[model samples]
Target: MTLRRLPDLTWEDVGALDLDRTVAILPVGATEAHGPHLPLDTDVTIAAAMAEAGGRRLSAHGLEAVLLDALQYTPAAFAASFPGTISIGGATLAALLTDLAASVQRAGIPTLAIANAHFDPTHLRALHTAVSAINAGGVLRAVFPDVTRRPWGGRLTAEFRSGACHAGQYEGSIVLARSPERVRGEVMRELDDNPVSLSAAIAEGAQDFVAAGGPQAYFGSPAAATAEEGHATIETLGDILSEAVIDALGTETWPRTKEQT
Candidate 1:
């Protein structure tokens, strides 16, 4: 059967799909400053692209998957001091997530996965809380955060550690890869220093990275970012996410409890 994108699918069409077999992917991102070089919508753009790629792959495998509209407005506590940054409080973000998950459950989609591109603490907490609620409600079987888990997580994590993960090389590369025109290469050259190291601070549950000594509200070497690396990262992340979705669909526990549905 030909797969239908969620945006294109009518309410009747969604209602017709086997609810038990359908999967919904929600792309979660934040509107935050990524230095002067990148657009404020970087997170949403990347998350949406990744989710679309994953949905296509799942559909190719005969499992139905659709990309939901992104949850773009989110917590940007780290970049709160920066202009053009739009962030919400933790409680607000959690409420949004909970409502979205509940809507998906009511729509009859058995599996729901949130594809997150931003790493804000508040955003993470909200997402986790939503997943917990969905799981408790017995409407969702599995929820995969950071779709990089199964196949390419190790590689991505390694790259992230190698000065590519932060707003520097890795994120810049993705922005360039997804939309070269949106990147300001010259501006990136000026903010080339690593912002702050979170290895120690994160353990203590700090909210803002800038407050922890990352003055520029960025990290890693922006000069090192390349369109090639961005493309490679996206492709790798997409592959891993696809495999994860397929695996989740194949599991018996997925869409775990049928009592509520």
Candidate 2:
């Protein structure tokens, strides 16, 4: 079955679906500064690509996949100083996620899977809080494969694992693969590698991009990004999301065990 975009389907179309075997994939991202070379929506692009890929994979596994519109506004305190960065309250984001899951549950969808690329601490915390609330509700299952954590973190490219990957080769490559036109080719080629790890900075009590040693709102190697690497990394991200969803479902059986009586 082809992966469906939720917005494109009418109420009748959605009502006709066997929601028991369906998964709604939400692409979570942030509208924040990446670098001089990349667009502010870079995270959104990557998240959408991951969701698309993951949705296809879920379809292959016999579950109907529905792609929800991207979640673009989130807490981005780390990059708040940047000109185009838009930051929201962590509590607000958490509440939104919780409510979203409740609505999905009421619509009869069994699972909501997140395809996230933004890694701001505030944003991560919000996601954690919302997922906890969603699961506690006991109706909707929220599947979040947090790439910043262990196991999932280990599966990405070296640049991603380095913790200095904000708008660096890791993210730049994915943007290059998914939306090359959004990249500033001239500036990207001249950028020097900023290997200071943002993760390490946060651990050491640093706040915001400048304090993390990324004065230009960037980190790691940007000049080294390639579409090939981006594609590969997206595939890895997709696999991570798909596997998480499957695991959360508690079985490989996508087919419903019994008819809905």
Which model scores highest in lDDT?
A: 2
After superposition, which runs of candidate 1 have C-alpha atoms over 4 Å from their true positions?
Answer: 1-3, 147-152, 157-159, 162-164, 204-207, 251-261
Model 2 residue 100 lDDT? 90
Give the whole-model CA lDDT for all candidates, comma-separated.
0.73, 0.92
Per-model TM-score on C-alpha atoms: 0.85, 0.96
On TM-score, the candidate that comes out on top is 2
Q: How many clashes does each candidate structure show, in the order listed?
A: 2, 0
Superposed by TM-score, candidate 2 places the C-alpha of residue 51 at a distance from the truth, in angstroms, of: 0.5
lDDT of 1 at 126: 71
**In model 1, which residue pairs have backbone atoms overlapping below 3 Å?**
141-255, 195-219
Assess candidate 2 and give its TM-score to the true structure: 0.96
RMSD of each: 5.3, 3.5
- lDDT for model 2 comes to 0.92
Which tens-of-lDDT digit does each residue in 1-261 have in candidate 1?
344568898999999897777778888888988777888888888888777777776666556787788888998887888898998988898777777777787898888877788877667777777677767877576566453333345667444754334577878888898888998888887775674565345656666666555666666778888888888887766766666676665645333324325
